[model samples]
Target: MTTRAGLITSVTLLLFVALVAASALAQTNDSVAAACDAKVKAPDYSLPEWPEKAEVKVFIVAADFNPEQIAAILTPLRNWSAVAEATGSQVTFVYSGPTAEHQDCLNCLTIMRGKVHDNQKHAAELQATVNQGEQTILYARLVIDRVIPNLTALTNAVAHELGHNFGLRDCFECRAGTTVMGLIRSSDGLTGPTRCDVAQVRRVYDHVRIYSAEVKRRKPQQVAKIVPVDEGEEPVDDDTPIVVKKP
Candidate 1:
């Protein structure tokens, strides 16, 4: 009992709905692609610092970083650590000097701040690999320099470098309010990681699983333990030895 015109109208409505659904799906895929351009792959090489151990050891390799500068570096780290913990991916940092002990530490983040190399114009550089054959990173080292020496710039640089260390890529053009993973300095003037930044941390680390056999083979010794502290506590004193705080 249906007319030909009625059949055509019904077909048109169905096509419209299908088109809307396809468009929505495409947008979702694009959003995922934009956020994680370089997703964290399965680790061919594992480190003791990552996964369930939940600790990241930091060694200050450069003599240039005074206590104030060190504290500035720690601020964003502390914030990010808290963000990771909120998502059930626990992480804390143990600050250390460039002693022989640090040389033997397997998965520490060795930080050096000084003049950038001739070929490097960026404010910072992060290197972590073994002979470039193995794609997995066992350790991450950060070298920071003054491409634009301002407080906000340097702080944001540290935050951005830390994001790379945490296995995130530059999602500069992603539709977010602000992020530390921008390719260039953001005019938003944010000196720390934003909500978008923390969300990335959660995405990467929250469901991380440790491979037991890999940990057994690498067996890195714990450099220090973390002590719980209030989030609003003052920065550590200049002359005091570096300490690890619970996230």
Candidate 2:
């Protein structure tokens, strides 16, 4: 039988251990900020040659959210700059107070179509097809809300959702593991969709395919070591932090 004082000491020790673990996880989450060389060496991602110029607009409905929350939501927006440059496109960000007038003039398209979306207008206009449908848009909402686990998960959600609008459907293996589209549904254990997603802007603009035939040709090459399972080692997951690219 443990004494009361002894029990309290054990509890305190457990709490301290838990806090230490949480701190370590927080550091891991900020891995991108620590990168010094990621942008420099990637063969695929350089200053993407603009076939013409891409016009990407981000309309964030942030009225209901606190400014601090909005800032957190925008934290991943920097990745958009990288994505845009890779695609040879220009990006426009639309958010609270500053873009109030533009909301009235905004084009009606999907923002997100979840039960609780960051923005309502985008939800109302979201349209999905039989092949690549509702779930794609829903995943983006989860990313915006930061309901997913990591930066990889969030970035995957955005990339997947944007894929749906373009007419690309979920990839085959994406239904199981850590794909940009698969992570959301697989993590939740849901049925897979039938169709694929495609890019809408390609009709009028020079499209840089994201995870498609073109981007497939341009996908990031593994500069770091990749041990195959046959070599008595497990293959590295893309999300694994292997080589710290020092910028």
Per-residue lDDT of model 1, residues 166-185, tens digit only: 55554445332356666434
Q: For model 2, what is the C-alpha lDDT against the true structure?
A: 0.31
How many clashes (backbone N, Cα, C below 3 Å) per candidate?
Answer: 0, 18
Span of 10 residues, lowest total lDDT, candidate 2: 226-235
- Tell me the tens digit of each residue's lDDT in model 2 across 53-128: 3233344554434555445445434444334433233442333332322232222222321332322111111232
Question: Which lDDT values do the candidates have, in the order given?
Answer: 0.50, 0.31
Candidate with top lDDT is 1
TM-score (C-alpha, index-matched) for candidate 1: 0.56
> lDDT (0-100) at residue 228 of candidate 1?
13
